[model samples]
Target: MTVRVRFAPSPTGMFHVGGARSALQNWIYAKQQGGVFVLRIEDTDAARNKPEWTEGILSALDWIGISRGSYEGPYFQSANAGEHRAAATRLYESGRAYYCDCTREDVQARTGSQYQGYDGYHRDLGLGPGPGHALRFRTPDEGSTVVVDLIRGEPTFENKLIEDFVIARGDGSPVFLLANVVDDMTMGITHVIRAEEHLPNTPKQQLLWDALGVKPPVWAHVPVVVNEKRQKLSKRRDKVALEAYRDEGYLAGAMRNYLMLLGWAPSGDREIVEWSVIEDEFRLEEVNPSPAFFDEKKLRAFNGEYIRALPVSEFIDACQPWLTGTGTIAPPPWQPEEYDADAFAAVAPLAQTRLAVLSEIVPNVDFLFLASPLIDEAAWTKTMKDGSADLLDAAIAAFEALQSWDAESLKSTLEAVGAERGLKLGKTQAPVRVAVTGRTVGLPLFESLEVLGRERTLTRMRAARLRLV
Candidate 1:
């Protein structure tokens, strides 16, 4: 059988990390089997769905490199309303589904408030289609539903306890079960891989498929991603939005790598392998059955490793978007016209090692582009206290007389100045570093000074000397 998989997401708001994980697993499975992957938008929940949210899902997928070319479609589930209605009508006419004109209050009154689900009061009422009635599938009362999940192994549910679930609402609108099964059948989705939270709904969907007399797909419900508190990540409580991570300067490649490791681990000791390695080695059977923790610290660490692994030029290129700003991210302190590519290229190497995300590049090198650096008051006070004036003055004179204004000469000159002052280079360079870069911690001091030019360097040092007075 050709492995066919689909990532059917409901566009309620921001594209979530949980949704990304599911999509990625499906994509990996398809690639591993050399089969087809499909993107289906389950927009049947019209009240909560938005066009912008749908666009966000597609954009997020593209950002993470999930393509549509090798796949089938981003087919909208709502578009197949006619097929869904026809299926519902077929079940209703075939005695597999029946109209129930009972409300929650009626069921509770008949079966007491302790009753959990629909009591099936109208199951054999022999009622035809009418107002104030929902279409519920007549579940078998004697057998069991064996969900043969690949991840968790086969789990059986007693049909007696499995309530007669509604397939369509009172207004004749097809619910999730009907829409989902109909689309899966019509689209030929061979494997139903999704979050473990949807596992309970599978037995009901399987029953729907059986009622419709169509073979259901293989079900593999992976573990749900939870927060530090062990609760499922909620939009209100957790920063789980995938686009938010993108805005915060995370590389999409790193995000994909980190996300893939949430519930499944590769064979070897390393988790930072390339995408091709993952595609070649990924297996659904090896997925863990337990909950996966969405640990931000580990993800950040992974991102840092990926950032350092980037080539210098590509790192600079990646920092460009965050430097200028995109969407809600405000631009760096420096003006766009003030940005000097060659100067930044000179300092990019120093920033790359210190960076965990692309956004950190701006703060590390913003001093180079700004007309006047944003001086850190604490750094200035700490480095240029009383007794530091002579140090700054001496360094200014040393830098001014330099024949060649390069990193090597600047380093040697500064070291010589520190020696004359009876201080080590590390000790003496503190005041100079604070004076020039506005912070003691930043890109390498001499190299930054070289890129800033002799004139600007001297101007800042002299300005620092005068400020000490």
Candidate 2:
């Protein structure tokens, strides 16, 4: 049988980081098995579904290298409602399932405990289907169902412990559990590689697959992604959106590389490796079954490494979205006309080292393009203290007389000015840096001054000296 796997996501909100990880895992597994990767939108929740959310899911998948057309049908689950209902009917007719009118209150009244699950009150009742009737799978009371998983070992669930789950609602529409299984069966999925959160429902789904007279797919429930507190990463509390990271200037390669390391690592000592390396070495069996922590700080550090590893040209290209505020990125502080390409290219290497994300590119280079430095109030108050007025005067005079305006010449020139004041280069450049770049710290001071050029640098110094007066 050709190996088939599906990445089914509900188009409700942002494409979650956890969901992205699952998609990548499924994609890799399929590729490794020489199988097909399917993209299925579980847009069955009509109350929460939107067209844009579906498109966002597609775009996010594309961003992570799961490009459109590379995978099978983005076959929507809603489109297969008929199949879902038919499977529900077949299960009921075969004695594997039955209909009953049991509300939450009714079940609670029967069991006398709100904490307990359904009491199987509807199992043997020959109640005819009606407006209030719900279809539930009649779980066997004897043996346990063993789910063969790739990452996790065979997880056994007792039939007695498993509740008689509802397959279809009172309105006769199939619920997610039945619809999911039917859809998987319809698509010929050979593997079910999903997050560990779905493990509880696996036995039910597996039962559905069996009752429907179809063999269940191979299962591999990867570890649940958690936050620093070990709580499952939640949209309300955590920055879990993949698009948020993408828009923040994270390289796709870096994001995906870090994502893979959430539950599994490559062979040997390195966590950061090429995509080709990951594709070659990734194995579901090797994945750790513990909860994977989504460390944002580590991811940023990984992104920095990725940004620094980039070829200068590629780095420049990558920074464009944040640089120009194009696409989904917000516009930079400077106007479009003020952005100087040659000047940015000159300082791009210097800026590249300091940036952990692409968004930093704008602030690092903003001072170079603006007509006047966008001074930071606190930096100005802190740096332009007592000898600053005198220092700017001396530095401006020294800079004006310079024969060549380069980073080397500029550094030596400022060094001498600071020396004359019995101060170090750090002290001397503090006022100059803030007088130029809005921030106290940024790209190498001399390199930045060189890019800013002789005229603009002097004009800014004179402006600073006047501000001090």
Best by lDDT: 2
What's every prediction's RMSD, in angstroms? 1.8, 1.0
Please list the C-alpha lDDT of all candidates, in the order they appear: 0.89, 0.93
Please name the candidate that would achieve the greatest TM-score relative to the true structure. 2
Model 2 poorest 10 in a row by lDDT: 121-130
TM-score of each: 0.95, 0.98
lDDT of 1 by residue, 1-469 (tens): 9989999999999989999999999988888888889899999888899999999999899889885465688899989999999999999999888999888888888888856688888888798887767899989989899988889898899999888888888889889888999999998889989999999888889888888898889999999999999999999999999999998889999999999998898887989999998888888999998999999988889899999999998998888886777666778888889989988888888889998877888778888888878899998877877668998888999888999999999999989988997889898889988888899898888889999999998988888889888
Clashes of 1: 0
**Tens-digit lDDT string for candidate 2 (1-469):** 8999999999999999999999999999899999999999999999999999999999999999999999998899999999999998899899998999989999898899999899998778798778979999999999999999999999999999999999999999999999999999999999999999999999999999888889999999999999999999999999999999999999999999999999999989999999999999999999999999999999999999999999999998898888788999998888999888899999888888888999988888999889998889998888888999999999999999999999999999999999988999999999999988867999999989988999998998898889888
True-vs-predicted CA distance for residue 393, candidate 1, Å: 2.1
Q: How many angstroms is residue 337 displaced in model 2 relative to the true structure, after the best TM-score fit?
A: 0.9
